[model samples]
Target: MSTKTLGIALLGVGPGSEPHLQSLATLADSVDLRWALARSNPDKARAAVPPSTRVTADLQEILADPLVEAVIVATPAYTHLEIAAAALAAGKHTLVEKPLDVTLARAEELVGRATAHGVHLGVVLQHRFRPGAQRLKQLLDSGALGAVQSAVLQVPWWRSQEGYYAKAGRGTLARDGGGVLLTQAIHAIDLFRSLVRVRAVVASQIATTAIHTMETEDFASALLTLGNGAPGVLVATTAMYPGRAEVLELVCRHATATLEGGTLRVQYHDGRSEAVEGEAKSGSGDSIMDFSPDAHIALHRDFFGAVAEGRPPTVTGEEALATHRLIEQIVRQGKERAA
Candidate 1:
């Protein structure tokens, strides 16, 4: 293990920034959060962190700092590419919030730039770190679950206009790129894809329901095929009132596993079964900060180790882009069918 502590900074101090802030606190030994950039509320951001840390509105200042070795892009989806590219260009090991960015092309550009700069890039798809998800992944890899013959991904979270979508650029295509799929379901989608490769989106539907006045879809549903020639159905919507824990179910040849929150319930056909739990509080409800910070802590720890040891993080930008590719196809194909 690399013993050197990483010097890190956070770009943007807003909704998505809190989880990382919480994580950095837990990872103070391996990571040092030396700076923050809060364009809207510098005072609030400053008060949240240690008095020794600097909070500013200037991106250039953070970029020019020799001590700031890495930056977490907690900015909005549309702003990810611009901010992360600058950090990568400055040779900082960059980690951006999920969905990579607002679009696939831009996500590709950002990942390519990181590669060109010879720096590390990671995405905050923390669901992959959940204990249950990790165990399920290990089982699949070891063939304990057999082949995934079918799967189901559901993120039936809830958010009201006042609680979520009403914010400026909250559900706007210009800022968020899309609604439920991009903003909320991306984590589940990333984890789902990790568990089983989605060969294609066989069919899909994307629409904005009467729940909000957003410019993007609040509901998205799709039928997908797995790489193993199986099938899966994915339904993600924030319109589900009084949201429940998201679920990922994979029906393998030998057994079926249901992952809800941090708990994984597995049942084998031969009368064997088990339920394992891990850190599982995700903002599956009205507030986006409803989740636990342990996953973020784990993510940051791995990222710092990756940076120190000259290796890829647990969820690399390139690996994240694959999720974006599937998301783009879902949105595109769904919109086409809607048209």
Candidate 2:
């Protein structure tokens, strides 16, 4: 006797196609990929997936397909709300990729709809499962780091000129939401807020200093006063050389902890520091595209488990909405400063 597999419909198969395909393939036993939706390029969708899998431009086709119990919305940022809402309304579970939605209001609507329908809704915040990051979170949870005073996030990720130009909506406010902070650094920022128990973000400021081409900022920094009265700094840029490392360092009363390149380093006030090793996906060239299909797989596994056990997924839509509100506030502050 075996458990029945959940059927899934993939809602986008363009530039960001392979990772989701691989993730589905890895969990094939648990997931039946019923359809691949390509509203933009149906030919590209056909080429991206195996001939055995079905292809359709209509999301309703997937919803009507009795086999599809869930939908993975991999469309562009702007269309996430529209597609995800449809999937949820059709009585299917949903796993939407990061940012949840470009705006706080849309995210809230999605959460409310999912709750009303009694369906599981998850957001892809896979970075939390990284071994080193998980260990650091554990330490902080145990109060081993003591009272966290402040933290800094340095994510100087690099993207090639061609990469930015390749997509019409790569660095635009209309499509991509914002630049590095919203796209790249939100993962780290979300983690920072989670670890610090950031109940209230008192203030935020943003600016575009480095990348002149993009409508949004390539370089920006912000100072935040957390609800618990802890201060923090977030600095991110897509303009850097030789690639850049994503680092998060937390200063506490008893010890200071830093995580970078899969290593967790902690310096205690007693003149002792310890290092715990980990591994992150690295590219052959000097590009900061450290994405892993395994991360997406892990995310799927959790979603399926939650559906079967009737529990909430690790990154629920409601929790992600909180992060979206924070980002909206930051962007509003940035716009004010520019005005």
Candidate 3:
């Protein structure tokens, strides 16, 4: 029996493109980075590809290749559903970047199609892959952490005009999804949901106060009651200057788990705390800052592992639907208050 190579075709070569390439490089022997489909410009795709990789402007050509086993939908927010749907229909495993889709309806469409097609449908919520997060997961599962009680997420980052203008469709309701919470803060929120095991958000109040220029909320806060009956607070603001200082902290009966700067810190009731380290990137200001790439690398490893073992991917489509629903609820509730 030949070891099957998972052929991956990258659909977008935009800002968060490098991480997937790095994952392909890191997992070179396991998965093949066969092709890149840029938007009508194969040159950009060609430039982004490492040697022995094909670059094409035609997504159809990539999809038509029998060797291509999966499609990584790193396209913009709005195009995720369409691209992912196409990939799933093509019988390819689909890994979509975050936000999944702009609205709950589109998200359902993609999630539903993937389910019917019986292909692996995963989202890149990579923060959950950090060693700190893994340790926390183990601790919680082992009952070392008694029960999650409360959580707080603070994502204060800044974005400038230059970063907004860098892309034609950025920060718009149509393209980038919402502001910080939707694009930037969702990572923290998703991780929060995972740590606390939030199944259903009961009743909540949402408020949006800062950043008026953008179509969506730049600053928003919400109070949520998780399915397990834990209460938590989520606050995301892009109005803060000097770029990113993302933090996700959860307080359980046994320990206080905190994640920041790719490091997860846990202070246990037994008087022991450990820190998990992550890779570093040098960047300044809000507009150009993101953790999607690191998340993608982590996501890739898990997806490939699942494929190899014939198991489900970590952040499955159904799981992602809950995250999307949470965001949608917050945004809708915030809008109602604003009205």
- Please provide, for model 3 over 50-152, each residue's C-alpha lDDT reduced to its tens digit, 9 standing for 90 to 100: 7788887777888899999887888888999888888899898988988889878998999999989998998977778866677778887898777878877
TM-score of 2: 0.90
Q: How accurate is candidate 1 locally (lDDT)?
A: 0.88
Worst 10 residues of 1 by lDDT: 278-287
The true-versus-predicted C-alpha distance at residue 176 of model 2, in Å, is 1.4
TM-score of each: 0.97, 0.90, 0.91
- After best superposition, candidate 1 residue 190: deviation in angstroms? 0.2
Candidates in order have lDDT scores of 0.88, 0.77, 0.76
Candidate 2, residue 78: how far the Cα is off, in Å: 0.8
Please list the residue runs of candidate 2 whose C-alpha ends up more than 4 Å from where it truly belongs after superposition: 1-3, 270-274, 280-290
The digit string of per-residue lDDT tens for model 2 on 157-179 reads 66655666345777786787777
- What lDDT tens digits, residue by residue, belong to model 1 across residues 1-339? 477777889998887888888888887776778899989878899888877789999899988999889999999899999899889999999999987888788999999999899999999999898888889999999999999989998998888999777777788878987788888899899999998988889999998888888888889999999988899999999998888888999999999999998799999999999989765566876667977898788788788888888889999998999998999999999989978
What are the per-model numbers of colliding residue pairs? 0, 0, 1
- lDDT of model 3 at residue 196? 76
Which candidate, 1 or 3, has the higher TM-score?
A: 1
